[model samples]
Target: MRKSLISATAIMLFAAVIQSCNRKAETPMVHPDFETSYWIDIDLAEHPVRGYWRQVESLDPEEVSDSAGIANASRLLAEQYGANKLYVVYHRQFELDDARRIFIHWKTEGERNGLEIVPTVVLECYSEPSAMNFSDSTICDFASWCVENVNADEFGIYDVYIRQDEGSPQDTQMGILREAIGDKLVRIGLQPGEDLNSYCRSGVEDTWTAECQGLDNELWANPDSVDGTDLYGRKLLASWVAERADSAQSRRIVWNMIPVAWDYDKPVDDRGYVCPGDDALINDPPILGRIAKCHECIVEGYTDGMLTEKFGGYSCDLHILQANSAGHPDSISFYRQLRNGEPYTGYFASAMNQVSDLYKEIATFKQAKSKK
Candidate 1:
């Protein structure tokens, strides 16, 4: 009788342990606290993988072909696992500072998924004039920038890919550009295949360049090699953005500054003028105006503000404004506006007053002197 009782107790304990293990195993892992939208940075060549994950299935059983379907499906999976927002930094190619800015953005807005470096396939898209830029290895104009700025410590390891979604081009290699970025990528259900070895065999010989160091100049200059435009350099914007989120003492805010001219037929305000007036007027008519119409305006075009205005609210996850001569910045005022996702439409100088106070409150003791 004694032996039987002991045996029964042991059996019960074993069953309990098994049940606990099963429950844990069944519990989904990733959490979803961050935003649900993702900005994909795929090259034109990786269509197979993109299609597999983004297309193919209807994320919602009821909805047919809504754009948010895949995002919703991914969100559901994340909820089951315990994850947050699904913001993606989609750069066919980006520089070091840009990657850092992206990291800073991740820190501010989304659940940190650590850093993922994985093998991927992508499709390449380019204009007719740039046919010479494509090759089996990588694009030409962007290569030097990649060689200079790509960093293992900052961006992490990734298996690069060339996508071929549209019909293959005459130059087959033009459709592919393969390299690895970082490591945390998993073969989620919507992905293409599972063979990790399919990527580059030897892997990245190096990530960062010894020549690339300073945060001041190179930080914002979008590689001049790719496009001749001044719009690519991301320095000041990245700095302000990074400080807003990463600084523990600081508050984050959203500032929406659209030109009165954007609503052309509508009455113009006393804010600012339309930039390159004719060009912007033709492209985005409603957003352009003359300096005579609005005297107090700051920067003229959409480039004037931190966050990009979309159809409804701002597109960027976070927002910020510049400082003033009085050593003020609009951190708090903007924070208040965004506390409940409110819209901010104020004068640049006045807004700077709010930003100045917020900056002082959030700025570290070390930076306090800078304000003075």
Candidate 2:
């Protein structure tokens, strides 16, 4: 009887171990994408000095010199945006290899927000060429579903389509798009008979096509032409294209095109296109409007460089800078000044306040228990 009891106990322990392993396998650990890590590092760095010079003796020399302050500040910023907790949950519950499955999971999470328990979530996914075939109708179906389900008022989807093929013919490539998406195609920056390949070519420095040039001119002439409605229309089409092109099997090519729109009452001019400074356009024109406007903007690629420079200042609250990555160091310096309660005016001041308000809202959301 003692030997039988010992055998039974051993069997039970073995079964429990197997079950634990199976659970872990079912939910593989996840980690932040490469771009997320890069941005996090940038956020943790000391604010570079810019504009004014002031000399103040440190009361606690050790505290002043400690690098952890920067990291802590970054953590606080992430927490305010809910990105930190979002990433934590994502890392524990999902894996990156399965792009389609991950995207569906993200959309489902967004839907859960309708119940008012889950915070409205944006899922940004990176796909390899192997997992995508731009000619597949199934991918288009998936994109259409996502677009239909996306509650623009609450949930958002940011997908980064990575392509590997270097030099494919314009029509040939675009033909696949037309075939896959059918009537869903919404052309932007391209005129009838003009192929996307002719305008934007890979491996070329002067890659901007004639259509791109035309769009730039039109935007400069009339900022309202690229307003919110126009931008969102373009984004919806782009999302479909991205979904069709993204595959886990492809290699070497990646395209990130983010379309954004601004709604403002102030007049915009060429100066508005430049990064805000003392020399920036007068009245500051709110730079890019408010953070809420930015929330509505389509985020393409690894960052918002295109939207910030060519289009205008990005009102995206999550981004610390209004300009491209190149200007981040300078922007960080300005941000630090604003944080220290230094005097600011124009668009810069307005943007800072908007971010503050957004942070507060997220904090409130975090504290509230979900109905679910």
Candidate 3:
């Protein structure tokens, strides 16, 4: 509560003092050059529970394989409006020379696509069965594989994400990564609203949260930064101080918003697009509006970076949690995308008409629980 009040006051004072003369407006306005430059990390898995990328393929076997749909989805993201880069994470989907085969294939596709594709290789899912670990040999072996076989020089793994879900920080993991794939950017991802407190060994539980410990890499959400029931104030930036901080990574806020899916148990097409459920976010206006507002704040925050020249020193990557069972493009129904259910199979049936008929079934029959 105090932090929220303080933040509100600080931001208010910043405007009052920082711009006493040019204060023609009452509220903050985005600059003319303001543009969203943050990378949108999109996860492919729907039900990425235990053996998501490593062991099992999908919730069903008859539909789209996890490995095949990524390329098309990557292309779609590249072609979309608010997204310029795809920070994709492919742990172990295809049959790898254990993993080497699929890693190369993913990179090749990324390179061919010609977008800002940051392929991150996970080296820290030690708890989950079949997931990668952080052992000396394991770490060294993966690092060596990247440098030697994977070729860290090409469109290689630029960023490496470590998922320590159990809240146990591998204190030595950073040093080893630095020594080996130091050229590659390394950051740790923590599950928001969970046992992040355990990550902080120091008893300063007030401000030093598990999110703040990322120092370099901050919140990496599979679904979102905070759950729908939870407020943003309750999690992020609650325990951050600009001055009394150790390093640039720890000094400020950094988040990676990867809005795709949390428990994705749906069917997918040839494209990486997942067939959204009736309870999917696209159906609820209130939640969908919230998601839009969250992205709006993220864009505003990133644009604010233009104010400071030296703020670059702070290793900040504020993730706008654009998550939750990746948006159903075919069912872009609520917003002018919904259309007629009748099939115009006569001479008038055209390509455009067929496109509109995509989600006609849902519009004609399906009713969301919230809507009812």
| Clash count list over all predictions | 72, 19, 13
- Tell me the spans in candidate 2 whose CA falls farther than 4 Å from its real position: 1-38, 42-66, 78-289, 294-349, 362-372
Local accuracy of candidate 1 as per-residue lDDT tens digits, 1-372: 999999999999999999988865543221121111212222211121222233212222111122232333233323322222222323233333433344333343322232222212222323323222224444322333333333222221222233222443422332233233332121111111212222222111110111111122332233232223332223323333333334344321222221221222322222112122222222121112221111111112223221222111111111112111111233333223322333433333332223223222222322333443
Residue 186 C-alpha lDDT in model 3: 32
lDDT of 3: 0.33
The 10-residue segment with the lowest total lDDT in model 1? 205-214
lDDT of 2 by residue, 1-372 (tens): 999999999999999999987755543111111011101111212321110011111111111222333333334444332222121111101112233344444334323322111111112112221212223353344434434543222111111122212443323443454354343322112221222332222110111111121123334323332332332223433343333234333121212121112322232433233222222222222323333333332224213322222221111222223332223333334434323434333235454455445434434433332321
Give the Cα lDDT of each candidate. 0.26, 0.28, 0.33
Q: Among all windows of ten consecutive residues in candidate 3, which has the lowest summed lDDT?
A: 201-210
lDDT of 3 by residue, 1-372 (tens): 999999999999988886864543323332322222223222333333332333333323212234454565444333332333334443433332445554555456556654444444444342335434335565556656756654553112212232333433443454455566544543324333323222221111121122212111212111232223221221233222222132343322233322222222322322112223434443222111222223333333443532332222111121212222124444322111101222213211232222223212212222221233
Question: So what's the TM-score on candidate 3?
Answer: 0.43
Per-candidate TM-score against the hidden true structure: 0.23, 0.28, 0.43
A best-first ranking of the candidates according to their lDDT comes to 3, 2, 1
Candidate topping lDDT: 3
